[model samples]
Target: MPGPPTIFVARQPIFDRRAAVHGYELLFRGSAENRFTGGDVESASAINIEQSTAAFGLDALVGERLAFVNLSRGALLQEFYRMLPSERTVIELLESVHGDAEVLEACRELKRRGYRLALDDFTDAPHSQPLLAYADIVKVDLRQTPEALTPGFTSRLRGKRLSLVAEKVETPQEHRRAMAAGYDLFQGYYFCQPEMIETRDLAPSQLSQMRFLAEVSRSEVSFEQLEELFRRDVAMTLRLLRYLNSAAFGWRHEIRSVGHALMLMGVRPLRKWAMMMGFLRLAGDKPHELAITALTRARFAEQLGPPAGLEHHDSELFLTGILSTAEAMLGRSLRDVLTALAVPDMVRTALLDGGSRLGAVLRIVMAYERGDWPTVESVRTECAVDERALTDAYVSSLQWAETSAAA
Candidate 1:
């Protein structure tokens, strides 16, 4: 059966002056097929965000930190802020929302209800002045405005009590400029970029775990070998037992042995679960979205395999999708990471080169992820898959990722 609608929720962290994470700006989108319909972008985005938050809960996306959500004029008029927790949600008024009487009245009402409000993509204009009365924070787009004019614009707001947020601060120089201009909050890719580390050697424990993962990924994995490997790692053994005993598995009896656990889960699911754990451990201090993306890709590729005429090799396709992001997660090339894990030749070749069937599935998954529909369509046609199957795979992958992440 088809699963839930495909919803993508990404959080961009907002940092205070001391470089502490103060909150996150929650970005959300609906399924790739329904994303762009030439409608009002802000309203559509607002609806998607509202639906996603309802389905997944706000804490799943932003943890305990404040969530800044963009509200279109329509959403503001609907009093959407009333539905969210006032203390934890910051209603960001989109730049497209003119500071007219209705919007201002709505903003005033929201403030009266104890909800904090922010002005998104703030620019010094005559029309924006009225919003200042209700705005607790104002975000200025560094990329859209000239550096020479930023100081002048920000200085004019010095008398106001609102905190200034500098958006799109993409470089060290821009960060410094924002700091100099007395901006209290910062957001952008500058903070999330992966820091390249020269040493690529896995820790001794991680090496052992990878070896076990490689064994499980084999076409013919032995139960005895998995039992022996689990026996060596006390934490893994306990985790497996706990997972087996959990309500999700609905085991009637307590799992007392590693072999028993392996028998219950079977080699296929065990391999996928272990690989996910290993990759997440290797991710270290990387952003949470990295794990989400990897798992989503893995599931998407696996589901797409049957439709793409590679049903017999779905596991290999899944591995290819997961390993495609290894370079970003491990700060090393895909070849090096795969070699370290001793992945299958087909999976390695698919990731390193772009000719294999698994490679084609990976390409389609990636293009679909980026909403590059034309490229996705071309690859889908080449693989002889229809749009419905592809959309179902994508949506199901998203649902699996969300559920797995919560687990």
Candidate 2:
């Protein structure tokens, strides 16, 4: 009745291809007092804008690392985009929006202001003609359509412009079908699956960032010195604060700089966060969904912590587990990925081979997600954490994330 309290980004088999996750759609469900909106379309229309938009923004800002949400054409017409951060998100025009002059013009204006636009479930329609001019990405629903018809339809629309994005892609086969059909972007569950390809190069900026963070985290630098290190990288500095001030940080006041962040975040948490920051740096958003999923996994692993003393090994465990989907993230080999980044050999073994204590901890984290209580229990016994303790940790962490954190 309440729908899900939240829509979780389903993390699955990391597929063997390259795709950037621009943003995700947030489909809504009504409050207890309100009538339900049937179908993702009419349901999208049934809302009171001021209430739901604010709620969605507040919820997303608090819970996620920047995500893109869908706004109904009516919502879009109302200029809901004005209220949210334009760069960090994309305004999706639901398939239900008619391709017409007013809508198209409004879309152009949003684009002019630096907002990204996504066209959903496109087919060869006269209405879509105008919309595609300004649409940055096209989301094709694979749940209802097969691949055979994609090429002609997409070719007619794409014609040297716009990337065709295959959405609702749920399996490895679906991924293959979409890729073969020339879909420039992909979304779905294939990220969890093992693929034959090796790793690829991350953007130069991303590489430089991870290298910098790795050096900073490992340096004999003081908190004061750490401030200078972050200052050297403006984007990284902003992200660290955003992540810190986010509901994720569990802090008490406004944090102004890297040194302040270090003092509040502490050495262990700082190291864990620095590695996470490193991962984000290494994987600067090219394969967007994979990046988001990896971010989730890293956050999950960080919250779960590592087994005591393989000696400062938990941070490495967090790094490895976050990268478990490396193959799917970049459609390449795990070994190749490590080599490209020059990741240490120890991390290479734990992440790719899935050997060692770190690997075992990762196994438990995955098992916990699958609701495999017994396997979780086995790992818990091995790690010296009891079931109750693990449950408590999860609850406390969620509360901390939801309430005390400020970045």
Best candidate per lDDT, number? 1
Give the per-residue lDDT of model 2 (tens digit) for 185-232. 666655432111111111123444444434333324367645665666
Error of 1 at 269 (Å): 41
Best-performing candidate as measured by TM-score = 1
- Specify the poorest-scoring 10-residue window by lDDT in model 2: 194-203
lDDT of 1 at 244: 60
Off by over 4 Å in 1: 32-38, 147-150, 193-407
TM-score result, candidate 1: 0.46
Residue pairs in collision within model 1: none
* Candidate 1, 307-378: lDDT as tens digits: 888999866876677677777766777677776665678887788887778889989988999999999989
lDDT of 2 at 65: 32
For each candidate, what is the lDDT?
Answer: 0.70, 0.54
